[model samples]
Target: MTSDQLVAAPETALPTLRGAVAGLPSYVPGRRGTGADIAALASNESHYDPLPAAVAAVAEAAGRMNRYPDMAAVELRERLARHLGVTAEEVAVGPGSVGVLQQIITGLCDAGDEVVFAWRSFEAYPILVELAGARPVRVPLDDSEGHDLEAMAAAVTDRTKVLLLCTPNNPTGVPISHGRLEAFLQSVRSDILVVIDEAYVEYADAGSGPDSLALYRRYPNVCILRTFSKAYGLAGLRVGYAITTAAIADGLRRTALPFAVSALAQKAAIASLDAGEEMEARVSAVKQERARMAAELAAQGWTLQPSQGNFLWIRADDALLARLVDAFDHAGILVRAYPGDGVRITVADPASNNRVLRLLEAHAA
Candidate 1:
């Protein structure tokens, strides 16, 4: 054969993506509602701007963009270690909670392995499991739209490598109780990793949310996932971390993409941690707003599932969901709607919150 024929053969066709990546459903972000008048409550982002401390930290770190971030994320991990009262070796830092979760899946699962989780929990769980070449075993949520931990336990087989529990579950806004979570933990095998995603923990009513750290202390297999994005108002900065056994943490760190967490993100997260009092105050405000919204929604003749997260859930069969979404869009308010399941409306500022309430009331009347 001629040299030209050999050289051209390699360029004739582009390599195709893996079936998993190509077949993966597109992750849809919250719609940026068209104008200033629009209330975009679709993403579950904190209603407030970044904390002053975080903003300042980001500005300071902006000048250092010329260099790569610290791959180990030593300072941030050390600070998180101090905050959580664990050794640095037990903490794993990543770009976001979802990123850390991806690392967990990669570290634990092999082709044909299985991972168990609640259906209608975090949407990313199944996708991540599939990406890792593992089979996803999803157990349906019980009638109250919360996890049926017993069913989940039954789904686990010897091949199960991971289990995920997203407390105050996304979209549904329902939290698993302390008693229930403990019981579930007791029933599960010790070697399998149980990831507790507490991304919305700060928004949960203190009395309702689980004291998961206490459980983690008791259960060596439990891995607590958290993010600076939700309550700390650092979503754009993309910083998250995990608290788990040193063995599991080491695996996560090893699987993480090098320099996944940026310097600016690290600085902002540390500053957010330092400003805990202010963060708590902001959380308190959101709780109040949630209570008010719940009361008004009930008065308007809607029976909502009890919400512990920063969002409210409305059960809408597919047909109803389409109409409701249309009406909401026309009114300049954006909410996340699950095609056949429900709608998730974030608790935002007073004006935006009131706007939503007013519209719903009008519809009911």
Candidate 2:
């Protein structure tokens, strides 16, 4: 090829040469409701408004946008350490739990490594593993619609570098039993990193779930992922963290994007931790709604797994599910439909929850 022709070709294909991002699929977010008086229950975000103190904290930090945030996130880590009863060096903060998961994958895996997780748990897990050039091994959930810890443990091989455990898993909302999870952890090799994602832990059954923080202390290779987006009601601020050994925490800090957690996010998270009591109350309300929704759906003959999280999954007939979603849209009430099988209905405020129940009852009748 002539030099002039090569030069022209390079300029023409500039967009393709941007990076190795060509293979990555763009993350699909749940639809937002901008229409007048729409109730959006797509994403499993908390319905409670941010505490006044947290709002003020974020607003105050917004003024310092001109200055760069702390690269190491020292203060935020300190607060999280106190909250988790760990040392500051054992905590690492990120933009969100998703970011933390990505960083963990990057730090541990390389090309050809394998990461194991339950199928249909979190949409991001496989994507993140592949993004890091690692293989994704997905184990099918048990018949009860929860992570089959035994199957997950069996799926692990020598190539397995990481295992992601999302308790009170998404869509299904059923948690793996405490004894089952501990037994699974004991089964896995010590060299493999286990990430226990507790994004919805606050809404899970009180004594049924395992305490990942406690497990982390017992197992050096374990990491606990937590988020402010769920019960804390700080999804907009985008702050989450990992509690692990100091060595794993250091690896995450080194590989994660610098200053990904903003000053406002950090400050707001601190305030949220301080307002823990109020958040606990909100979680209680969501739990009550979850139970109510489950019982109502079960009695209506919709097949459902027992959900311990804020959302309940209903296996509806396709035609009925589609019609229900369309009717809801017409009424300005939005819920998430998982393409072929069923719809996941998250519990909102009393009024919104009642509206949803009434609509379902009318349609079911």
Candidate 3:
């Protein structure tokens, strides 16, 4: 056809996204605040500044940005191995625990394979699973807002490849106890990979959650995922890791995006691990704040599940949720709102926490 005729004709079909990608729900991040007075209690990020050593390390590593990062993340892996008492061969470092989890899913899951997890846990769980062309099976949380391990165990089929257990689960902030998790592990098939995501472990009180390392030692199928973003104050840098068997860890490394962890992030993570004591002190402060807030909220006649994470979960129906969302927005405070579930307010500094308290006090029954 002539150029004019071809131009008049319809263009060829444009490239389209895969069905899985096209149908996937976008992960909604917490709303960021612009005003100085706005309290950012949306994301469960540490309200404190990065550890001094981490900051220093990032600054020092800035000069080396010209070179690509260690693709294998050797130093960071070795450091993390030492920290977790695992061999370097059994450690894999990625951009964040979420990133490592993506690697895990992509490495293990084939098309149509299944991954089981608790609903209202991490929002990323199903997203990652679907992106890997795997089916996501969600087991609803129990009455206490913790994982329904029995249901999760029962959800598994021969096609099931992975199970994600988020301790002190996000949004809800309820933890899976050691005994329950152990029993659940005993019930599941040994061939399936079980990932225990502990992004908020630093904020959890001792004995409140699973001893993941011990569980890993007992079950080769166990994988422990963690991040430096929360309590270590390295959220901006984007570094996290996983502890798994040597073969599986190696496979995850292969699946990781090349140089995904920047040199700055690697240095910051190493330095943060080195400053463990200082990080622990900060975590202790957050825990204290969390307890104080919980106690005050209880006294206010708002019964709540004991949150093991660094945030508080207020379970609300649609009407109450709308009121709290509006009030928090009007008061220059940002928090995470799950439409059908509840609102999660990060336990920030005393002032910010007080703002949340004042807002909730007005709405409490």
Candidate 4:
């Protein structure tokens, strides 16, 4: 029988699929260029090229493609542990921080549990929760477009299995205060896991954000998710990790897709760790550029949050945002626009930033 005809037969029992599995939506990555010569800034990525050391490491590791990667990811885990001042057992490396997140959800949450997170955060939280057959309880951000910690804590209930926290939050660029974070953690039940997604932690200024890793030490249920994708300029490498108690790390390691992290990626990440001087210099440049972009936008009467991350969140009506996006697209410049009042622009290189600013000015005029 033909493949199409066989599927049409009612007597054949269809392959069973979980309700959640069949309904799961695919994750959308940040916009990448399909056309030639587009200055894309939709995703908040580092402007500089990958470090020479990382490149060399990846190249060297390419020769070993015949063998499977270390399932335990021992050396990489050790390096990360040393970098974070944690034991190797407390660190779990995966394809990316998102993998670590998936592992955690699979290991800790069962069907019908609830996951609490602030709306307009990483966009992935709710989707991932739903894929796990868990309900996503979203708490709206405060007037400042930051997480409403008190409201989020209050949202916690007996059914809440996990609380996803994003500081210097994505798209909004607001950080939760150390005091507020501590209070929120204390208020939540000890059994509930708190996943602090700190993907942009390197770009966050020292004074504004809380020390989530320290909190992880105090709270056994807390997991700190970090990535090499942002400031490390390894977005293409797909390397990230999680830090938590040994038990949680063990669970993540057990459930994670084996060898999801390529050998080259692991080597490149280890090399990136040693490129601290270069990374710090790039971060400084990004901070300066971010400040300039926010000021330029504000001068044009656009409202912007005091961005702590490497991007600025500007507020404008939906129509205005659409017009700006269209103008930018026509001018070969790309930025992020949400359905609501949020528009995000990352601080790219000086030339790209200048071009983007000129496009915005023309559109505004």
Give the Cα lDDT of each candidate.
0.91, 0.85, 0.93, 0.87
TM-score of each: 0.97, 0.93, 0.97, 0.94
Tell me the deviation in Å of residue 205 in model 1.
1.6
In what order do the candidates fall by lDDT, top score first?
3, 1, 4, 2
- Model 2 error, position 31 (Å): 1.0
The worst-scoring run of ten residues by lDDT in candidate 2 lies at 11-20
- For model 3 the local lDDT of residue 58 reads 87
| True-structure lDDT of candidate 4 | 0.87
Whole-model lDDT, candidate 2? Answer: 0.85
Residue 104's lDDT within candidate 4 is 85
Tell me the deviation in Å of residue 303 in model 4. Answer: 0.9
- Candidate 1 residues lying further than 4 Å off, grouped into runs, are 1-12
- Which one wins by TM-score: 3 or 4? 3
For candidate 1, the per-residue lDDT at 204 reads: 85
Candidates 3 and 4, the one with greater lDDT = 3
Candidate 2's residue-wise lDDT over 32-144, tens digit each?
A: 89876888888988888998779989899989988888978898899988877899999988989999999999999998999999977888888888888899999987888
Stretches of model 3 off by over 4 angstroms after superposition: 1-10
